[model samples]
Target: MGNAVISSDKWHPVLDRCLTISGEEEEEAFQLLENLASFMLPYEISASPLLQQMWYIIDNTKYDGNDKRLKALSVLTELSMGSADKMQLLIDSNKNARQVLALLLCRGKFDVRQQVLVILRNMLINLPSSIPFLVERQTVIGVSDLLTVMHPDTVILALEAMKAILENGGSPMTPENNEPSFSLLAEEASVHSRLDFLVSSPNEHVALLAMEILHEYIDPNDDDIILPDDLIDLTLHPLS
Candidate 1:
């Protein structure tokens, strides 16, 4: 808990032990890694082997149980809350990370899916390059499914992720890569109707976020549709 800076000399051994141990000891090892990772700078952790090691644990679910994997995911989520470089490292370090996270979002338990959404939200906001990968993985569909969760915070997170996607959508990955934008994908997933319902949410924060997402869905060429100045200001500076 001290401000002492963590170095490779200190963390490398812990990383190794975290991967090699099992049972409660392994759980403690992962916990220790999480603590150490929190102390290390995002670039430091992303630059180290720890990132790949965590990815290994996350990708190879057979290597351990859900507890350890979730712990590993937590570490990644923490790392991703940093600069864009760190988020890019999380994706570039593992070829399967996006696919695995998307699959988890679609089929994993509620807690796991929530964690994946947080990570995806970070990626979409921080790393522009991740948009194509996420689009290719049909991440919007997975995100669209979370709008109905009873937890307002989780619902808000899902909406924020969708907002980020729409902000970056419609840009072709390349001249010939004809992948659909996230905006189109969301429409196909019936996210618009879902947002329409959420706009009437009892929680004002949730309702506002839903309205902001709906605003993003508007066509730029259509200038007749207008939002109130206060609503625009509130959306620009979210309560969160």
Candidate 2:
């Protein structure tokens, strides 16, 4: 019983099949992907092509079911956990990184959504240049999906991302052209209304976090906060 050698030549075919197969073969495909990720450690496998395929699979909605997308996201999260530099390089290489992230936030299941949130959190914290791009995407894709979730811990995660973006100066959303993007995102996501919901959350930590975002959104000197009339009404009559 000798240890098996894991190499790109061996794993690439498996990953390639995972990308191409669908429907009746989904479970088999997912298993291959699972094995690839497991063997990725202690073997120094090149993940570039694998990552590209995963993103490709994610973008292709035709074969989106059967937990394939979830498997892809899981592998990505695992890869990212090992190296922040790798994560940054992934973003730099993939022009659609923001688009993929936004789509995942809107479509992924609970675990998938949480992993995407962590990616966003890390990118914002470690790569300041990524702020504007991520902010625009998240605002448009709607953080409300996570913010308005039932789980208190998940709610805290979403709120934490908002706090990071704003604290890192995402509130102003520089370069004037980007300003309207955030406004539309805020309006479409009904962020102000969601903040109202979170402020009264049963979890005191959640409530405080929401309050901080709300405060930053309304900070007197900041010109970017757009409060829709409905948001005003909700604030005025929280019980109504």
- Model 2, clash count? 0
Clashing residue pairs found in predicted model 1: none
Clashes per candidate (backbone, < 3 Å): 0, 0
Off by over 4 Å in 2: 1-8, 20-48, 107-114, 137-141, 171-188, 216-240
lDDT of 2: 0.61
lDDT of 2 by residue, 149-218 (tens): 7888777767766655655654434433555545445656677678778877888778766766777653
TM per prediction: 0.82, 0.68
- List lDDT for all candidates, in order: 0.73, 0.61
User: What local lDDT score does residue 192 receive in model 2, on the 0 to 100 scale?
Assistant: 69
Top model number, TM-score: 1
Q: Candidate 1's residue-wise lDDT over 1-240, tens digit each?
A: 554546545657878887667798887778777776667766576567888888888778584446767888888887667666666777788876667887888878788788888888877766767776654435677898999889998898888888878888664343124656667778888888898899889987788788766766634444533555666343322121
lDDT at 43 for candidate 1?
58
Kindly state the number of residue pairs that clash in model 1. Answer: 0
Best by lDDT: 1
